[model samples]
Target: MNKYLELALLFAFVLAETVGMWRIFSKCGRKGWLAAIPMLRRYQMGLCAGRDAEGRQLALLESGVAVGIFSCIFFKTGSVSYMVAAFLLLLLIIPYTIFSIRVYFGLCDAFGRNRFWVVPWVLCDWLCALIWGFGSDFKTAEGYPFDDEDAAPEVSGIEADLTAPGLSINITRRTAMSLFKRKVLLRDIHLIIPMGHMVLLLGGSGSGKTTFLNAVTGYEKANAVITLGDSNVYKEYNSMKYDIGFVPQQDLVRGSDTVYRTLSDAASLRLPADMKSDKRRERINEVLDTFGLTPVKSSLVDKLSGGQRKRLSIAMEYISDPTLFILDEPDSGLDGVMARALFEKLRVIANSGKIVIVITHTPDRVADLFDDVVVIAKDAKRTGRLAYYGSVYDARIFFGKKSMEEILMSVNRREEGGEGRADEFVRKYSALAAGGEV
Candidate 1:
């Protein structure tokens, strides 16, 4: 490479690394400025570790564990240079070498081949360093395994959801030995979402609400049977995927695109090929109007208010008219009026005979808005399990209306009856769940 090009290449790499990691921070609900400062990145990393995906701290621990063994071999290379080289040769060349094996696994992971790819990547990162030099293009490596993968998932099907399909999901332990670790994060539970019905799920922080949402889409695993009507969802996904719609907790919208273009492109990609541009535009306008966001139809996502942005997210998910509209914490940053308005939109969708589910915190007014509700609570350690699952109306009927002060008392203090209020809440919720009342 030319001297100037090398310098440019180095600068480009540095800039890319900086921007990529900065975007990662912003994605975690933090400002991007922290990524520019080295000390701040470390500090934020620690602060964000516990709350990040799969707890980023665990990622650090795994990387730390891998580096420990790698360092032991690396630094000792000077004193045992020949021995080190010999060992390297043996490891890389011997029968089913760990290096080659891990490299292969990393390739599998890069292409999203399997879940256990991390096992190979951590063990073989050093070997990969030797195989593909720092300056080399990883995508063009001679050992790249694209040819090994028989087929790749089609992007078209992955992003779309089919029309109203009845689903029946069943979770069973089979026996007691299966009971070991039967307590799952989300997918093991049994819930039936009939067509055209709406449900509101409530939890404080976590209650496996998110997990249950993931279960619907098959992101989370379960020994249980997830049936779409009488057909098994898992078996369908293995052979052919359903057109499911999801709006995750955060607005992962491409901030650059204007609302019009964003929805247009999304619809074009997700909708059926036979769908025309006129119908697409009409559908977009109808969705935008449904959420009272028609006025800002041309605004860039970054230019919208928090409330406007949230409405847009909901609108986008239902643009294709999905059978099930699933949203995670759609109420996350909305206020009383905005939350109420959003619920009304969900209500409209529900009344139209589509299934709508909202994961919420038992909003004072929205309680009446919900046709059904499920509550999830956590133990002292923040470990969550479903505390209740049932009909909201019945739970209210059983508990009866309490004065504002009485409600506050329950919220603020334990029971005057000498029992733990938190425990009482657990029992009340558990009873509601056991009785099939929210």
Candidate 2:
């Protein structure tokens, strides 16, 4: 073959590879310009493959190869030291090459591609990139099963003798205008909200956090399945509604009425008529005591502090001895100290054997106050979708951020140009849930 022909073919392949990578980066919710850079392209490729470890490994390989080539050039001087350095570099290169191959295979698995595609990725790499960029869907890889045998046992002294068993909620959402075209906001959301955990529902504006809470409370319509102990929410909602309570963000107490009177009125409205007046009064006092409003029980609702007002709202919902509580932005319009105090109150409420779900927009300082979290993000089509749902500690690790605020910032930064990868997160979680691995 002619040398010029070989050179021309090399140029063509390089161009194809560049174009392929550009498309792939764009598809993976990253900036396409990253593919045009030299070392950045490899890093971007690793990110597209759905794991930072892959990108780091690729970068290490490139560094190792560069060092080895430099050592080889120096060895031509016939220096013993250069030869030793080259030998060591060669040793490093061998393991790096093997690891790089493993990373490549892992990338293939993550992208749902054939393992043998590594061949084209290594030889005619442009063809592999083209196939992956165009044909493969950018989604996260399946997670491995959690080994409970190696897990630590719970030692908390507070045990729940649950009167209301934990609830499992599932919802599939669609718009009224497009009934035939179902754009799922929440998909197969299976959460076992136990009796003694404060769950924080998190998402950006328009991420459907409010909608989810409303659906769980049976205020919003959807294809939903909610189970409480042996009862189906759909079939037994009239009876089950007594077991649940919802506290809206806005204060609901009558400003002119005293705290005690407000709760008394609420109890009268919600409690059964068969209950004696003394029993209703006893229940109101108990709720006021539970929320730590006994001292301010005689104060007018308008005169209560902001935190006290919030607690009053919660206390109103507790009139019927509800076993499950859902609060929307309980910390809104409060200072940091009051917010923390409110969260502490919620923690105590959860510890009392009630399944508590709190929704808040400003939770950075109070992220640690919740026992668990349900995180959602907006997809490419601007539909709300679940991003992560698990323990707060695990969520930090999953998002690679130290705090929920940082995680939200990272997500926002990723979606700055409207290339949100929330759909990918949902797809991955769905696959994991179906396989019973998450």
Candidate 3:
């Protein structure tokens, strides 16, 4: 075939596909111009097919592959060998193909077409897109599964006594923008955790567990009212920050520093600056003894054992002596015995009149240590909704599950191998809250 003829044919194919996709995008309530952009077009197509997650992965992979190929062609004089480039391309193509197939199948489902349509899509996607894009018979069979709802129903729950001293969180809604559309990550989460209580935060993947904690800590401010003993976390973040201690899952300690020096540095930052140097040192020593790090105070962080490192992480946060302490997977990577011992230490902290909230995947190991459990689940619209918030004993009874893990399974989606009762439980809890039965 003549090179010019081949180029003309390719141009026609590309134009036809772009036109088809533009129409398809319009049909799905998306801007038709999106189809003109390479990466955004893939993502929008995925959104239309209800496979936005895969679409995101595909878009990123496509960009990486494009850059790799471009570099191999133009930067051959660089260190990137053609052999290495070909191998890397193979690695990327495998997953790219998988994600592309998934998006195509999703599109088929959206258009009420059979699975066989994927063959044409895989072999001749340009022609396939043109047909689907321009064919009057091709119309969206059902609304996009993830389309934003007109309004989310009000959520009601047992409100704690405002006069009481505790950590209170009243989140109206936490939203984010995705593909130029507003998405609610969490909504209508209200609860009060009394001081001297250890509460377990539970949720499955993408259920907004981390988001709720961020809202409570005022790290990621949401449209919510969060108070820690009369201090507004959002409004008075500067002053209230010292009253809240958040220990992330990964320890942020330097290996070169000794345990005592680590605590001393933390004290300098966490404690008020006006305090005398001797007073700060004394407080650091106190925290060292409290977390049983006194023996290892002189040792470098790299030399300490896992349990000791974990304790040091907690001690750094405890140096602030905050009224509200939040830890995400404080016992991660520890053995059963170490986890139990760590939870015991946390239990003691809660007993000392501090509101302690923790997120642990292995909650049952220390179930007895927690005073309450806060369960969050994704509703039909995929917004995180409060399914239950009460004592662990009551949680078991409410979900008719004997263990925390079982309760989690009960609320997870059926595709996730559970009962798919998240919406049901959300509604039931809302009703119970409205009736003041919780």
Candidate 4:
């Protein structure tokens, strides 16, 4: 290669190495700038592996590598003494090399990765660094994965004694094509959604999943009779509005406000007017700690990660402690782990005596977390009708399917004329309206 070309390639390689290491450091909750330094990056990597102890040892090994390389350069000068000194330095380098391998494996293990990472860490350091930084989920020093028992202790004080009557919904939707021309969207939904249950609402695009949510929240223009206990939903919107909380698909928070500030504002606006400011402030603190937002309470809404933002949005409504909480596509932008965590939190909230409904398209992985699932399938006329309503396992058996996705595909195929399966399932399961425990 030409001299200039060699320099360019060297510079590019160094840049990639620096950036990759920097990202790893950042993900490990260390300052990324350490990667830009000559030897300090190794020390930071040690800190990431556990704490300062490992870092100190790694730094010493890095020093050995440096000394060995310098000694080799001196040995090239054709001096016997320099060659002997180089041999002594090479001996130190041998142990340093071994420890370096151990340190790399330690880094992977600390971040919940297996020893399989050793090959990439040794042979393809750049790729290893990139994956470590961008792919791993690093917990903070204080954050530890808790067992089910410990998890309960972590959320001890945040539990609420919410006692609301169970809800049984019966709604009918029809389009206003004309006073005479009408098409039904939802055909008489008469399912009982009990208080304190986590429900999953599954549907495909244009399947009226969102439409059903709006109807329940009294947002859509529809002719429907929805009853929570003995009260008609539409007839009692003014009195029942406080009993419900709806989190739309998109966050409705101001990006400029911190998490604490946004939630405080929500509580102030939504809480009872007779409530004192001190009580509101104390409740805000409870909400923050309940949802694991205490650490990021000062973080601006726009600056939070997608998962944090979603939690914050839910927290905004959770501050009210509504009896019925409906979240539309809360898992839309999150990864599988984040989506699962979000649903797990919702499951806890449901267990505390409130109705929590999540409308989502991707419900397969987290389906087990929900107590019941309501599937809405659209027909040839673009109407969303109930295809199945039952426990996750029973819904599978009721539809003769293994997965939510499989059941949805079967419903759509039926709608598209393969079979009248959806209609038949709805007919057979109509007894759910008459106290059937699905």
Best by TM-score: 3
Model 3: residue 405 alpha-carbon error in angstroms: 1.0
Cα displacement (angstroms), candidate 4, residue 319, comes to 1.1
Q: Report the lDDT tens digits of candidate 3 across residue range 1-438.
A: 554575577678767778889999998778999888878888888888888888888888878776665555544444558667767878888898889899999999988889899999988888888889888999888655544443336566445454557988889899988644578999998788999999999988788999999989898989888888878889999888888899988988999999999899889898998999988888988889888889889999999998899889988889999999999999999999999998998999999999999999888989999999999988778889899889999999999999999989888876678777787777777777677553
Tens-digit lDDT track of model 4 for 1-438: 354575576566657778888987777667999898857877777667653445666676667766665565545455887777687787776776665677776676666667787777877676667666666454323341111011101111111112335666656554645222254676556567888889999877777888888788776646666667667668888777777888889977899999999999899878998999899999999988878899999988999988889889999998989888999999989999889888898889999999999998788989888999998766544467776777998988888889888877776644354343454455445544344553
lDDT tens string, model 2, 1-438? 554575577567767777888887776568988877755676677666654555666666666666665565545446887788788788887766665566567667766667886776776677877766676564434551111122111111112222346877655553433311344554434556776889988877777788787777776666766776667766777777777899998998789999998998889877988999888888888888878899999999999988889889988887887778889998889999888987888888788988889888787888887888887766554556666777899878877778877666544424354234455555655544446443
Model 4 — TM-score against the truth? 0.58
Cα lDDT tens digits for candidate 1, 152-254:
1111111112232555545431211221123334322345666766777665444456766666666664555666654666667642233567788898788
TM-score of each: 0.54, 0.58, 0.78, 0.58
Candidate 3 residue pairs that clash: none
Query: Judged by lDDT against the true structure, how good is candidate 3?
Result: 0.85
lDDT of each: 0.54, 0.71, 0.85, 0.72
Which residue segments of model 1 deviate by more than 4 Å?
Answer: 1-167, 172-183, 186-188, 238-242, 378-384, 397-438
Score candidate 4 by lDDT. 0.72
In angstroms, give how far residue 437 of model 4 lies from its true place. Answer: 16
Rank by lDDT, highest first.
Answer: 3, 4, 2, 1
